[model samples]
Target: MTTSSNSSLSDVEPSKTPKNILLLAIGSMGDVLPFVNLGVGFRRHGHNVIIAANTRFRSFVEEKGFAFREVNWDMQHEWENTDAGSPFMFDFLKQGFQKSYSNSESVLNNVDFVVLGTGAAYMYPECLFRNVPAAYVCFYPWASSKSYTGAAYGRSFDSLQWLPFQLNVKIWKTIDQVATFWSDVGLLPIYNQRLKELGLPPAERLPWLPGGAFEKNQIPVIHALNRNLIQIQKNPLNPLEIQMDYPSLNIKEELKDFVPPHDLVEFLSRGRRPIYFGYGSMHSFSDAESRVLIWLEVMSLLPQNQRALFSDVGNIKMKELDDAIKSGRVFIIDHIPHSWLFPQTCCVVHHGGSGTTHSVVRAGVPSVVVPHFADQPWWASILHRLGVAPNTGIQANAITTDKLFSALLEVLSSEEIQEKAAKIGSKIKKEQKRSPVSKIVAYIEKYWEKTKWDVLTLDDEQQKVKVKDNWRQVNGNCYGNRMMNGNDDMQDVYL
Candidate 1:
C-alpha cells in the first residue's frame, strides 16, 4: 500500500509471474511477527500471500488484509511449563493438524508454494500431499552439520568447544536429536498417520530438519540473520544455507508511519531518553515470582533522573513498579514498533530473542541481554563475542540484582560497546539494500517454475481445474475467503 522512497525490493522488480504463497507462522507473538513481516514482503513483490498461524493471531494477520488459516500450538504454555507435556499432545496438537489438513480443500487448493517455520514442519506432508514445493525460513539456522546449526546446539555444546570440530558437531547434532527426542516421538505417529491418509509413504523418523528434504532438493533454507554480526560456526558439510541481513520494516514492508500515543510522545519529549526493558513473549507463571522480584529490584535501581519503559505490566503487581509508572518513572506500552521506539532509547535491556537482538543492534545502541532458553543464551554470547554487549550475559534463572545492575551500567557507560553497536547498525542498514526477501522470492520462482495461467488453470495441464470459488462466509466473518473449521483454519486458500 505504501513504499519507502529508497525501497530495495523496488530496485529489482518481481518476475512477470506472480505466485500464491502460503506461509506457516505458528508460535508466540515474537515468533509469528517475523512471518507477518515476510508475508508483506511477498505481497510487495506481486504475489498472493497467506499466513497460516494460531487462532490467537487471526485478527493480527487479517488486519493486514491477507487471508489467514488457523493451526493451533500453545507455544507459550509449552515454554511456560516445559516439563508438563509435549507440544504435540494427541488430543490438542493432533486434532488441530488433522482439522487443518481436512480443511486443506480451502487453503491448499491453488497454493503454489509454502514457507515453513520451524514449528510448522509437520505441515510438510500436507504440502507433499498437495504437490506444493515448500521452503524453510527461521531467525536462526536449522539443519545440523559440523559447520552450522541452530543456536541451541551452541548452548548445549559450549562446554565441549575444545573438542575436535567434527566431534563437537556430532555432539551438538546428537544433542539436537536428544533435545527433540520427545517432539519427534510425539510428532512421528501423528505425522505418519496423516501421510498414510494422503496415500504417501510413512516417514521412518523425523529428520533433524525434515531429513534435509528442502535443502537436499535445492529448495532454499533461509536464515534471516546478519552473518557479519553473529559469527556462526561454519562447516561446508552442513546443508547449504543462505544467511542474509534481518528483514527491516522500512525496507521490506514499507509499513505506514508509526504513531506513538500522545502520552508516550509526551514521555519521549522529556530531555532524557528512557531505558527499554522487554522480556518478549516468554512470560511464564512458573517463574513469575522470580521475574517479579527481578523487576522490583530493576525499578528501584533505575538511576535518579533516568527514565525507563516496560513492554507491559507484570502479572503479580509490584508496588515499586506501580508507583514508578504512576509518577512517570516508567511507561507501559503495547504494539509500539521497535523500529520507531528503539532509536529513541538510551539503551535496551531485554530477553535475548532473535528479533529483539537484531532490533537492538539496528537501533545503533548498546544492550544488556538477559537470555532465558533455547537460542537466547547463544544470542547473548554472540552479542558479547561481537563486543556489542558487555559479557556472555546474565541468564534469567541465574540472574541476580547485582549482576544485572553491573551489566546495565557497563552497556550504558562503555564507549567501546556503543561504538561497535552503532557501526554494526550502520553496516546492517546499508546491506539491507541487498534485499534477502528478493533473493528468496527469486530462488522460489527460478527453481520451482510453474506456468503462466490464471488462478485455477495451469498451462499444459491435462485438465483445467477450477478451484472452490470465492467468498464462502468464513466462520460468521466476511473475510473474502473460505473459513477454517470452527473459525480456526481458513476454509479457502490464503491470498
Candidate 2:
C-alpha cells in the first residue's frame, strides 16, 4: 500500500490529556507518599491529578510537587491525640467512610479515572455506586494465599489450616457488616461537617468498585509491590514488576546546609551505625515524658558503639528525650525521607509499618520490629518468620529496655540475621525498579486503547463468591462493638 509523503511526514501530537484523576489516602507519610510518586507518573504521561486526603498532608503534598485536595478524614489526627482511645478509633473508621462517601462527587467530578491505596479501596464501592470508573492500586497484594489482611484480621490469623473458600467468603461478609455500621452511624456526621466546611456536596452511597454498578470481571487493578514473594497470583501481570525512574528529592543535600539544632548533627555523625527508633505517625508513647523515658530505656539497652535516631513525627518534644538528646549517643530530628535515610543505616528499629518495612527491607538492613497494633503486627510476624528481625511487638504501653534490648541485640550481633537481611535487601534493590505507578499507567493506557475511551466496569458474575455465614458464626463478631468516647481529654502526640 502506498501512502502520501505529506501524510507520512506530518507531525502528530500524543493522545489528549487524561481527564482528572482522583488520588486518595489517609494517615502519615506512608499512606501519602506512594500516591505522590504515582501522581508524578500520571503527570509525566499527560494526566491531571488531584489528591483527596486528610488536610494534614496539604503542605507535604504541595512540597512534593503535586496538587493537593483536602478531605475530612481526621482519624489519624484523632488517633494521634487520643492514643487511638478505643471507641475513638472506631469512630475514626466510621468518619473516614462517611467522608469518603460525602466526597465522592468532588472526587469524581470531571474525573476520567481513579487510583487508590488500601485505605482508599474500602470506599471504592461508593464510587461504583456513583457510576464512576475506578481501579484499585496497591503497593502490596491484597489477595495473597498467605495471611492477607482480609484473612488475618477476619479472625483467622492463627489457624494452622488453610481456610476453605466458603469460610473466607463468610469472613469478609462479617467485616463488611462491621464496616458498614461504622460508616453509616459512627462517622457520617463528621463527614457531613467536613463537606459543609469545604463547600462540597455530601457523598451519597453508590455501587462499589469494579462490581455491582460495574462489571466484576472487568475490574482493573494495579498491584505495585514486587511479585516474587507475594503469595497470591491472580492478576494478568502476576509478579508484576516495572522499572522505577522517580526523580530524587535530594533532601539530604537540602538539609546539609541548614544547621540542625544543637548536638543533633554531632550525635548523628557520632553513632556507630545507629538504629533509627521512631514509629512514624503512630504513637507508641502517650506522653512526652513517657516517650523520653522510652528513649532513655532503649538507649540504655544499646551498647555505646551503636546509637539511636529518634524521629519526632508525632510531635514528641526533645525535652522528653531529656538527657538522651544530649547524651551524644541519641539524635532527635523532626523528619527524614526514608528514601534517603534507609541506605545509610546498619539496622532499622521501627514500628513495623508496611511502608517502613518495605523501605528497610529494600535497604537490606536487619530490623528490630516493635509493632504496636493492626497490620504492623502482621508485618512483624512475616519479618520474624523470614528471620529478618526479632519479634519485639510488645504492647506499646508495656515496652521496656530489657525487652527492647533483647530484640535489638539479635539483629545487631547475629550474622545469620544480617545475612538474611542482606539477601532480602538485594532482592528489594532489584524490585524497587518495578515502579507501581508505571505499571498502573500502562494498564490504563492499554485499557483505553482497547475500549477507545469507553469506560468499562466490572460485571456481577465475576463479583459472585460463595457466602459462608458459618465463618462469622465461628469468629463470634470479631469486631466487637464499642462507641466513641469523645470527651477523653488526654491529648498528646509522640514520634
Candidate 3:
C-alpha cells in the first residue's frame, strides 16, 4: 500500500536511533548516481548511509563522500562480449547471487532500509527474510497500462501496432513471461536455494513484469521520473506506485563544486557549445568497433563551424579517426557527470536513457534521442510528444551519419523546442531546491512508521527464535502481531 500524498514530511521526527540505510545500485552509473544522491539525503537526516555498486564505481561513489561496498562485480566483466554458448549471463547467476549475498548480508547488520534499484529484483526475498523496511525504485515505466505505453525487451508497445489495446498488453505479458522463464531458469533456482539455506519457505513466483504487476506484493514502489515530460497511462492501479521528478542533482551538496578538467573547460571556451554524443554502456556486447567508428564519423561530419564531444566508453583506440581528434573540434572524454556537462552543450545526441533524457531536459537544452533499446524509444517518444526532441527519434540500428547530422541540426535550430526545454529545466531547478530526496526519505519514513513491526533474524547463529504472544503465523511466515493473508486479493506478504 502507498502512503498518502498528504503524508507530512514534518511528521518524520529525527530518529532517536539513526538507522543504517543501504542502497543497491545494480546497473550503470546512471542507476548508481541517484542512490548516491539519496544517501546524501539520508546522511543529512542523521542516519548512516552506504552506497553499494559495481567495483568500478567505488571512486565515483566515494567522491560523493559516502561509504561504499562492491556489489556482485563490475558489470562490464559480467557482460563481457561472449558468443561461446553464452549469449547472456544466465549461467553466471549462481556465482553472482552467492557473491552478492555474502557481501551484502555482512553489512546489513543494522540496515533498517534497503532501497533496491530497478534491476535488483532478485534481492526481494532477502529483504523479506531480514524484515528490513525495503522499497523498490524504478527509473522507467515498462508495465502495460491502458492510458500509458512503454517498450518491452527493446520493442515498443506499438510493435504490435494493429492489435486492440487489451490484446497489446496480453502480447507484452506473453513476451515477458517467456523472457522471465529464461531469467528464472537462472535466478529462481538460486533464489529458492538461498531461501532453503535460510530455512524459509520457497516462494511461488509472483508477477514481475508486463501488465505493470511488478508492484504487486513487492515493497513500496517509487517511480523516479519527471511527470511533465512523461505520458503515463490514464489509469494508475496502485497508489503506492508513485511517480516523482528525477532530481536535477545527481551528487550531494559537498560535491557540487565539481571541476571539469582544465582541458574540458578550455574546449568549451574555444568555440560554440559542442553538441554531445554519447551512448552509456550501449554496444558493450557486440560490434563495438564499428559502432565507435560510426559515432566518430558522425561527429566528424558536424558542420565545420560546430564542435562535438564524444564519450568513448568502449575505450577503442583510434588509428583512422586520429585526424578528427587532432582537428581540435572533437574532444573524447572517459567520464564526466552529465549534471555538469549537458548544460554546457548546445544540444545532446544520446541513447535516450531515462537518466540522460531527464539530465538533458533539466540542463535546459534540447536533444536528439537516438535510442538503442529498452525504454529508450519510450523516452524518445515522450520528448517528441513534449516537443523537446524532433519528430519521433532516430532508431540506433538504422542510424546513418547523414540521418544523425540532420537530427542534430533539427534540435539545434528549432527555437520552439529549445524554449520548451528551458522552461522544463526551470521547473526542475525550482524543485531541486525543495530536494526530492527529502520527500523520498519521508515516504520511506512514513512507510515504516505506519507498519510498526519487528523481525526475527534467521541467520546461522539463530535458525529460529522464541517469540512472545504478540508474534503470530500467516502464510508460513511469522509477523509481529500483524494479521495478513494471501487467501483474499492479490496478497501483500509480510509487509
Candidate 4:
C-alpha cells in the first residue's frame, strides 16, 4: 500500500496524468447503470476504466466495452430466496459485502483511483490505507444534511422542517442503529480482523454512521440527481455534497440498428399513448399475485381508449396474465430502455427506483409511483412534491385497485400535471450540454487534483468534532428558526 506524506491539496502530486481507474458498484440495475455510464465517460477521456460488480452483470458491463471484474453475488437470487421479514436478509447483505470487499482487494493493487457507490463505500478505509484516491457516487442522497432528511429515513419523517434539530439527530441515530445491527453482526468483526492482519487500525464502527465516511474521509461525494429536481435548502449541511445531473445513458443511438418487439411497437402505435407500468428489480411484496390483480383491475377501470404496458422484470408473473394479454389491454415487455420507450407513453407507473424516477422525469411524463421499498418512497415523495406525480404515492403494502385507479385517473386527466412534467423534462433536457457521466468524470478529475497535495487530514476524533461543529453552525440561525416554526417555505428549501 502506498502512503501519502502530510501535505496540502496543491502539493501532493503522486502523478500528473490520470491513472487507471477502478469503479466499484453493487446493487440493483439502478445502482450499476450510472457507474457503467461513468466508466464510458472515463474511457472516452483516455482513462483506462474497469467496472467491478456482481457476476450477473459481467455481460452487461462488457457489452459497454469496459473491463469487468465479477464481485460474486447475485442480488436477485438473494431477494428471491430470502423472506422479506426474515432476519437472514442481513446475512445475505453481509455475504455480498464480504465478497465485494474481497474482490475489490484483489483488483485494487493495479488501480490508481477508485469510484464507489454508497453500498461499496465501506471499503473506503481500505482505500485510505492503500493511499488510493477514492470518492463516492450516489444515486440518491446518502449523507445527513440539514437540506433534507437522510434518504434512508425518508419514510420515517413526515415533515422534516417541523422537527427540531435534536429530534432530527435522534431520527438519524435510530436509523444508524438499525444499519449498525446488520454491520455489527455481519461485517464489522470480519473487517476489523482483516485490518489487524493488514497491520492497519480497525475502524471504530461502520462508515454509514452520521459523519462517519463522508466527513471522516472528506472525499468528493457526487449526487447524480438533477439540480432542478433537488429542492434547494438554505445553509445546506455538507459542503462535500456535489449535485450532478442524473446520467441518462444514450442507448437510443446504440439501439437504432436494433429492433424492438413488434407487438410492443404495434401496441404503442395503435393506442392513445399507453401508460407504462414497471417495477424494475423490486419483488418484495408479500403478495405478488394480489399486486398484479390490482394492476389488472386498474387497467379494467381505464377507458377502452387508454392502454397500459408492464415490464415483467420483478414479481409480476406474466404466464398468469394470459387473459389480459389475449385481450390486448395489457402488454408485458421483458426488458426495454426507458429512454426509448417513455417518450411514447402518456404516463408511467413504477416502483420509484432512482433510475426509473429520473427516466420518468426526463421523459417528462406524469407518473403514479407505487413504491415497494427502500428509497422508493423518498423518490415518490420528491415526484409528488415536484407535482409530477400525485401526492402520497400508493405505498406497496397499502396498494389497492381503487388507489391505483384513482391515482392513474388523476394524473391522466390533469392537464396541469402533464404540463408540469413536460416543463420539468424540458428544463432537464436544456441542461444536457454535458452528460451526467461527463460531469462525474470531470468531478473525479477535479477531486484528484484537489486532494493530490492536501495535507490537512483529520483523524476520526477530529472528524467527529468537525461534524458536530458543522451541525451546530447550520442549526444555530435562521435555518433552525424556520424549521422549528413550521414555515410553509420550508418545503421549498432545496436538498
What lDDT tens digits, residue by residue, belong to model 3 across residues 109-215? 66777888876756765665565667778787645454445454555435565788667655655454455455556666877777677556554342244222234
Misplaced by over 4 Å in model 3 are 1-16, 82-95, 102-104, 160-187, 207-218, 231-238, 247-255, 283-289, 313-320, 391-398, 455-495
Off by over 4 Å in 1: 1-15, 84-106, 143-149, 153-186, 205-211, 231-240, 251-255, 284-293, 314-317, 450-495
Per-residue CA lDDT of model 4 for 430-468, tens digit only, reads 777457677677767766766553324656565445444
The candidate scoring highest on lDDT is 4
Candidate 4 deviant stretches above 4 angstroms: 1-18, 83-90, 153-190, 231-239, 250-258, 283-289, 313-320, 453-495
Give Cα distance to truth, residue 363, candidate 3, Å: 1.4
lDDT per residue (tens digit) for residues 300-411 in model 2? 7677767777776455555546566565676666766675576667778777776787777767888877666555655665676678876625546577778877787777
Candidate 4 lDDT trough over 10 residues, lowest sum: 1-10
Error of 1 at 317 (Å): 4.3
Q: At residue 85, what lDDT does model 2 achieve?
A: 24
* Candidate that beats the other on TM-score, 2 or 4, i.e. the better one: 4
TM-score of each: 0.78, 0.70, 0.80, 0.79
Model 4 error, position 214 (Å):
3.4
**Candidate 3, 437: how far from true, in Å?**
1.8
Give the candidate order by descending lDDT. Answer: 4, 3, 1, 2
